[model samples]
Target: MNTSLEKVLVNVVDQHGAVYTVDAMCERSNDEPNSFGDCIRCINIDDEIIKPSLDLHFHSNKTGKVFKLS
Candidate 1:
Protein backbone atom coordinates (compact mmCIF):
# COMPACT_ATOMS: atom_id res chain seq x y z
CA MET A 1 0.00 0.00 0.00
CA ASN A 2 1.06 3.62 -0.56
CA THR A 3 1.28 5.10 2.93
CA SER A 4 2.17 8.78 3.42
CA LEU A 5 3.17 10.55 6.59
CA GLU A 6 0.39 12.56 8.27
CA LYS A 7 -0.78 14.02 11.58
CA VAL A 8 -4.33 14.07 13.04
CA LEU A 9 -6.19 15.15 16.16
CA VAL A 10 -9.03 13.40 18.01
CA ASN A 11 -11.48 14.24 20.76
CA VAL A 12 -11.36 12.71 24.22
CA VAL A 13 -14.03 12.90 26.89
CA ASP A 14 -13.44 12.80 30.60
CA GLN A 15 -15.84 11.29 33.18
CA HIS A 16 -18.13 14.23 32.41
CA GLY A 17 -19.50 15.33 29.09
CA ALA A 18 -16.52 17.67 28.81
CA VAL A 19 -14.40 17.33 25.69
CA TYR A 20 -10.69 17.01 25.12
CA THR A 21 -8.61 16.73 21.97
CA VAL A 22 -5.47 14.90 20.93
CA ASP A 23 -3.12 14.64 17.99
CA ALA A 24 -2.33 11.37 16.21
CA MET A 25 0.33 11.80 13.51
CA CYS A 26 0.95 8.74 11.40
CA GLU A 27 3.98 8.06 9.22
CA ARG A 28 5.14 4.97 7.31
CA SER A 29 8.89 5.02 6.88
CA ASN A 30 10.90 1.93 7.68
CA ASP A 31 7.80 0.88 9.54
CA GLU A 32 5.23 3.35 11.11
CA PRO A 33 4.80 5.81 13.96
CA ASN A 34 1.90 7.61 15.71
CA SER A 35 0.71 9.16 18.99
CA PHE A 36 -2.40 8.70 21.19
CA GLY A 37 -1.92 10.89 24.24
CA ASP A 38 -5.34 12.42 23.56
CA CYS A 39 -3.97 15.92 24.10
CA ILE A 40 -5.10 19.03 22.28
CA ARG A 41 -2.46 20.09 19.75
CA CYS A 42 -4.50 22.69 17.91
CA ILE A 43 -7.67 24.79 18.18
CA ASN A 44 -10.73 25.71 16.05
CA ILE A 45 -10.15 22.28 14.55
CA ASP A 46 -13.08 20.76 12.66
CA ASP A 47 -12.89 18.56 9.59
CA GLU A 48 -16.05 16.51 9.15
CA ILE A 49 -14.73 15.03 12.36
CA ILE A 50 -12.72 13.00 9.95
CA LYS A 51 -9.53 15.02 10.03
CA PRO A 52 -8.41 17.71 12.42
CA SER A 53 -7.33 21.12 11.12
CA LEU A 54 -4.57 21.06 13.70
CA ASP A 55 -1.73 18.59 14.32
CA LEU A 56 -0.32 16.54 17.19
CA HIS A 57 3.03 16.81 19.00
CA PHE A 58 2.22 16.18 22.61
CA HIS A 59 3.69 12.71 22.34
CA SER A 60 7.37 11.98 22.17
CA ASN A 61 9.28 13.21 19.11
CA LYS A 62 9.26 9.60 17.93
CA THR A 63 6.27 7.26 18.26
CA GLY A 64 5.88 3.77 16.81
CA LYS A 65 2.14 3.49 16.25
CA VAL A 66 0.38 4.03 12.95
CA PHE A 67 -2.94 5.87 13.61
CA LYS A 68 -5.10 6.07 10.53
CA LEU A 69 -7.39 9.14 10.55
CA SER A 70 -9.33 7.99 7.55
Candidate 2:
Protein backbone atom coordinates (compact mmCIF):
# COMPACT_ATOMS: atom_id res chain seq x y z
CA MET A 1 0.00 0.00 0.00
CA ASN A 2 3.01 2.30 0.32
CA THR A 3 3.36 3.83 -3.11
CA SER A 4 5.92 6.57 -2.59
CA LEU A 5 9.10 4.62 -3.34
CA GLU A 6 10.61 4.30 -6.79
CA LYS A 7 12.10 1.18 -8.32
CA VAL A 8 14.07 -0.13 -11.27
CA LEU A 9 14.13 -3.76 -12.42
CA VAL A 10 17.12 -5.56 -13.83
CA ASN A 11 17.19 -9.08 -15.29
CA VAL A 12 20.35 -11.11 -15.62
CA VAL A 13 21.09 -14.38 -17.35
CA ASP A 14 22.41 -17.13 -15.06
CA GLN A 15 21.85 -20.68 -13.82
CA HIS A 16 19.48 -19.73 -10.99
CA GLY A 17 18.03 -16.81 -12.88
CA ALA A 18 16.36 -14.11 -10.85
CA VAL A 19 15.29 -10.49 -11.24
CA TYR A 20 16.90 -7.77 -9.16
CA THR A 21 15.46 -4.41 -8.34
CA VAL A 22 16.89 -1.12 -7.14
CA ASP A 23 14.64 0.97 -4.91
CA ALA A 24 15.01 4.44 -3.47
CA MET A 25 13.13 7.18 -1.71
CA CYS A 26 13.13 10.93 -2.18
CA GLU A 27 12.95 13.23 0.82
CA ARG A 28 13.47 16.89 1.53
CA SER A 29 16.27 18.25 3.69
CA ASN A 30 15.65 20.25 6.84
CA ASP A 31 17.63 23.36 5.97
CA GLU A 32 17.51 26.56 4.04
CA PRO A 33 16.43 26.10 0.45
CA ASN A 34 19.60 27.61 -0.98
CA SER A 35 22.04 25.46 1.01
CA PHE A 36 22.87 22.64 -1.40
CA GLY A 37 25.94 21.41 0.47
CA ASP A 38 24.11 21.34 3.80
CA CYS A 39 21.33 19.25 2.32
CA ILE A 40 23.75 16.52 1.30
CA ARG A 41 24.86 16.17 4.92
CA CYS A 42 21.30 15.53 6.10
CA ILE A 43 20.77 12.40 4.02
CA ASN A 44 20.06 9.21 6.02
CA ILE A 45 22.57 6.47 5.16
CA ASP A 46 21.92 3.92 7.90
CA ASP A 47 18.78 2.36 6.54
CA GLU A 48 18.29 -0.88 4.63
CA ILE A 49 15.38 -0.64 2.19
CA ILE A 50 14.10 -3.52 0.13
CA LYS A 51 11.31 -3.04 -2.41
CA PRO A 52 8.77 -5.86 -2.84
CA SER A 53 7.95 -6.27 -6.52
CA LEU A 54 8.93 -8.83 -9.10
CA ASP A 55 8.68 -9.84 -12.75
CA LEU A 56 10.28 -13.08 -13.98
CA HIS A 57 10.31 -15.55 -16.84
CA PHE A 58 12.12 -18.81 -17.34
CA HIS A 59 15.06 -19.80 -19.51
CA SER A 60 14.20 -21.82 -22.56
CA ASN A 61 16.18 -23.98 -24.92
CA LYS A 62 15.05 -21.96 -27.94
CA THR A 63 13.78 -18.63 -26.52
CA GLY A 64 14.23 -19.10 -22.78
CA LYS A 65 10.80 -20.31 -21.56
CA VAL A 66 11.95 -23.54 -19.96
CA PHE A 67 10.35 -23.60 -16.51
CA LYS A 68 7.31 -22.47 -14.50
CA LEU A 69 8.39 -20.75 -11.33
CA SER A 70 7.40 -18.18 -8.77
Candidate 3:
Protein backbone atom coordinates (compact mmCIF):
# COMPACT_ATOMS: atom_id res chain seq x y z
CA MET A 1 0.00 0.00 0.00
CA ASN A 2 1.30 3.43 -0.90
CA THR A 3 1.07 5.39 2.30
CA SER A 4 1.44 9.09 1.75
CA LEU A 5 -0.28 12.07 3.20
CA GLU A 6 -2.08 14.41 0.90
CA LYS A 7 -0.53 17.82 0.85
CA VAL A 8 -2.93 20.64 1.48
CA LEU A 9 -2.04 24.00 0.07
CA VAL A 10 -1.87 26.79 2.62
CA ASN A 11 -2.87 30.31 1.66
CA VAL A 12 -3.05 33.76 3.17
CA VAL A 13 -6.28 35.65 3.34
CA ASP A 14 -6.62 39.38 3.81
CA GLN A 15 -9.27 41.11 5.87
CA HIS A 16 -11.39 41.58 2.78
CA GLY A 17 -11.27 37.82 2.02
CA ALA A 18 -8.63 38.14 -0.67
CA VAL A 19 -6.75 34.89 -1.02
CA TYR A 20 -3.05 34.78 -1.89
CA THR A 21 -0.82 31.80 -2.52
CA VAL A 22 2.22 31.27 -0.30
CA ASP A 23 4.64 31.99 -3.09
CA ALA A 24 2.79 35.16 -4.05
CA MET A 25 2.73 36.30 -0.43
CA CYS A 26 6.44 35.67 -0.09
CA GLU A 27 7.11 37.72 -3.22
CA ARG A 28 5.07 40.62 -1.89
CA SER A 29 6.74 40.35 1.54
CA ASN A 30 10.29 40.87 0.27
CA ASP A 31 11.70 39.70 3.58
CA GLU A 32 15.20 38.37 4.04
CA PRO A 33 13.98 34.86 4.80
CA ASN A 34 11.16 34.73 2.31
CA SER A 35 9.57 31.55 3.64
CA PHE A 36 6.05 30.40 4.29
CA GLY A 37 6.34 30.31 8.11
CA ASP A 38 8.24 33.58 8.32
CA CYS A 39 5.90 35.37 6.00
CA ILE A 40 2.90 34.12 7.95
CA ARG A 41 4.41 35.14 11.28
CA CYS A 42 5.14 38.58 9.96
CA ILE A 43 1.66 39.02 8.61
CA ASN A 44 0.10 37.72 11.84
CA ILE A 45 2.15 39.88 14.14
CA ASP A 46 0.38 42.64 16.08
CA ASP A 47 2.57 45.35 14.58
CA GLU A 48 2.49 43.92 11.07
CA ILE A 49 2.68 46.76 8.57
CA ILE A 50 3.41 44.77 5.45
CA LYS A 51 0.09 43.00 5.30
CA PRO A 52 -1.92 43.66 8.41
CA SER A 53 -4.93 41.63 9.38
CA LEU A 54 -3.77 38.65 7.39
CA ASP A 55 -4.87 35.18 8.42
CA LEU A 56 -3.72 31.65 7.61
CA HIS A 57 -6.13 29.26 6.03
CA PHE A 58 -6.28 25.99 4.13
CA HIS A 59 -7.08 26.23 0.45
CA SER A 60 -7.86 23.32 -1.81
CA ASN A 61 -6.67 23.86 -5.33
CA LYS A 62 -8.54 20.79 -6.48
CA THR A 63 -11.99 21.34 -4.97
CA GLY A 64 -11.65 25.07 -4.45
CA LYS A 65 -12.58 24.78 -0.78
CA VAL A 66 -11.40 27.44 1.64
CA PHE A 67 -11.21 26.52 5.30
CA LYS A 68 -10.66 29.49 7.59
CA LEU A 69 -8.25 29.28 10.47
CA SER A 70 -9.78 29.26 13.90
Candidate 4:
Protein backbone atom coordinates (compact mmCIF):
# COMPACT_ATOMS: atom_id res chain seq x y z
CA MET A 1 0.00 0.00 0.00
CA ASN A 2 1.22 3.47 -0.84
CA THR A 3 0.80 6.19 1.70
CA SER A 4 1.46 9.85 1.28
CA LEU A 5 0.37 12.95 3.09
CA GLU A 6 -1.40 15.64 1.17
CA LYS A 7 0.00 19.16 1.28
CA VAL A 8 -2.14 21.70 3.06
CA LEU A 9 -1.65 25.32 2.03
CA VAL A 10 -2.74 28.47 3.79
CA ASN A 11 -5.46 30.66 2.34
CA VAL A 12 -6.28 34.34 2.64
CA VAL A 13 -9.73 35.70 2.00
CA ASP A 14 -11.09 39.13 1.37
CA GLN A 15 -14.29 40.73 2.53
CA HIS A 16 -15.87 39.98 -0.83
CA GLY A 17 -15.22 36.28 -0.21
CA ALA A 18 -12.35 36.06 -2.67
CA VAL A 19 -9.85 33.41 -1.69
CA TYR A 20 -6.07 33.38 -2.27
CA THR A 21 -3.69 30.54 -1.68
CA VAL A 22 -0.63 31.33 0.40
CA ASP A 23 1.42 29.06 -1.82
CA ALA A 24 1.30 31.85 -4.32
CA MET A 25 3.11 34.12 -1.88
CA CYS A 26 6.19 35.89 -3.15
CA GLU A 27 9.67 34.68 -2.41
CA ARG A 28 11.55 35.85 0.66
CA SER A 29 13.59 39.03 0.53
CA ASN A 30 17.27 38.32 0.29
CA ASP A 31 18.23 41.93 0.89
CA GLU A 32 16.36 42.12 4.17
CA PRO A 33 16.51 39.06 6.34
CA ASN A 34 13.42 38.27 8.39
CA SER A 35 11.49 40.98 6.63
CA PHE A 36 7.77 40.50 5.96
CA GLY A 37 7.70 42.92 3.02
CA ASP A 38 7.61 40.00 0.66
CA CYS A 39 4.50 38.64 2.28
CA ILE A 40 2.82 42.02 1.93
CA ARG A 41 3.86 42.16 -1.68
CA CYS A 42 2.42 38.74 -2.22
CA ILE A 43 -0.80 39.85 -0.59
CA ASN A 44 -0.96 42.76 -3.00
CA ILE A 45 -0.41 40.45 -5.92
CA ASP A 46 -3.03 38.06 -4.63
CA ASP A 47 -5.39 40.94 -4.12
CA GLU A 48 -4.92 42.00 -7.71
CA ILE A 49 -5.58 38.50 -8.86
CA ILE A 50 -8.56 37.90 -6.57
CA LYS A 51 -9.82 41.50 -6.65
CA PRO A 52 -11.77 41.54 -3.41
CA SER A 53 -13.70 44.74 -2.76
CA LEU A 54 -13.50 45.14 1.03
CA ASP A 55 -10.45 44.74 3.22
CA LEU A 56 -8.60 41.45 3.30
CA HIS A 57 -8.35 38.90 6.11
CA PHE A 58 -6.26 35.87 6.88
CA HIS A 59 -7.63 32.35 6.99
CA SER A 60 -5.82 29.65 8.87
CA ASN A 61 -5.40 26.41 6.96
CA LYS A 62 -4.50 24.23 9.92
CA THR A 63 -7.15 25.58 12.28
CA GLY A 64 -9.79 26.32 9.65
CA LYS A 65 -10.33 29.65 11.30
CA VAL A 66 -11.11 32.94 9.61
CA PHE A 67 -9.82 36.12 11.18
CA LYS A 68 -11.86 39.20 10.56
CA LEU A 69 -10.24 42.43 9.44
CA SER A 70 -10.72 45.59 11.45
The lDDT leader among the candidates is: 4
lDDT of 3 by residue, 1-70 (tens): 2222222334556445766544222232333434344344222222222332344444454444453432
Computed on alpha carbons, the lDDT of every model, listed in order, comes to 0.36, 0.28, 0.38, 0.39
Poorly placed runs, candidate 2 (over 4 Å): 4-11, 16-62, 65-70
Query: Backbone collision count in every prediction?
Result: 0, 2, 0, 0
Model 4, residue 32: distance off in Å is: 0.8
- Ten-residue stretch with the least lDDT total in model 2: 37-46
Per-residue CA lDDT of model 1 for 1-70, tens digit only, reads 4556456655544223445565544444444333333222332223312222334322122332222222
Range of the 10 consecutive residues with the lowest summed lDDT in candidate 4: 44-53
Q: For model 2, what is the error of residue 57's alpha carbon versus the real structure, in angstroms, after optimal superposition?
A: 6.2
Each prediction's Cα RMSD? 11.2, 15.0, 14.0, 12.4
Estimated TM-score for each candidate = 0.28, 0.16, 0.23, 0.27
Order of quality (TM-score)? 1, 4, 3, 2
Q: How many collisions between residues are there in candidate 1? A: 0
lDDT per residue for candidate 4 within 20-56, as digits (tens), equals 5553344454455543322332232333322122434
Please report how far candidate 4 places residue 51 from its true position, in Å: 8.5
